[model samples]
Target: MEPPRRKASFLASMKAVFWSFFGVRKRRDYEDDAVNLNPVQVIVAALLGVAILIGVLLFLVKMAVSQ
Candidate 1:
């Protein structure tokens, strides 16, 4: 029988993936360099940005269809 797997901590998992992808250690150097936003805030902003982008695209599409 296989043993139960150990759950990984959020920070540890994130750090491991960060280093593997970027080839460097994570730091707080950018923490105060600018306005810092949380994941939810970023996601919401991205969704809003995409919505605006899609609206513009659909407008262009409709214009082309009408022409």
Candidate 2:
């Protein structure tokens, strides 16, 4: 009988994804994430992070242009 996989929490997954976006992570952390993180949660987190980054950049550009 196979044991069920223990999924990491959403917050943990998001934190992992955030660090990934910043291009920084320890090898030990990456190994742990590979075992615990859910693929769907990671994808969602990555998308949300990208969207927020883009939104912030756009807002800053607009503010600069308006001045």
Candidate 3:
């Protein structure tokens, strides 16, 4: 009979490769203290914050324009 497939190992290997990019990250155990934000998360949050600010500004402008 043919050998069983090894799809599980392929997924494990991909996870290892993906996490290797952030080598030796410091672990944060304290729940009451500052938490480290991942780079991508920080970038995304900044973008969303900027978008919200812009939306508020535009709303204010429209109100002023209509008055």
Global lDDT scores for all candidate models: 0.51, 0.92, 0.47
Best by lDDT: 2
Q: What is the overall TM-score of model 1 with all chains considered together?
A: 0.46
Candidate 2 vs. true structure, TM-score: 0.90
Model 2: runs farther than 4 Å from truth?
Answer: 1-4
**C-alpha RMSD by candidate, in order:** 12.1, 1.4, 13.9
**Model 3: residue 57 alpha-carbon error in angstroms:** 0.2
Using TM-score as the measure, the top candidate is 2
Task: In model 3, state the lDDT of residue 35.
Answer: 33
Better of 1 and 2 by TM-score: 2
- Order candidates by lDDT, high to low: 2, 1, 3
* lDDT accuracy of residue 59 in candidate 3: 100
**lDDT by residue for model 1 (1-67), tens:** 9754434344444444444345564366333212333444444555665686689999999999999
Clashes counted in candidate 1 amount to 0
- lDDT (10s digit) by residue, model 3, range 21-46: 34532344222112333334444555
Model 2 has an lDDT value of 0.92
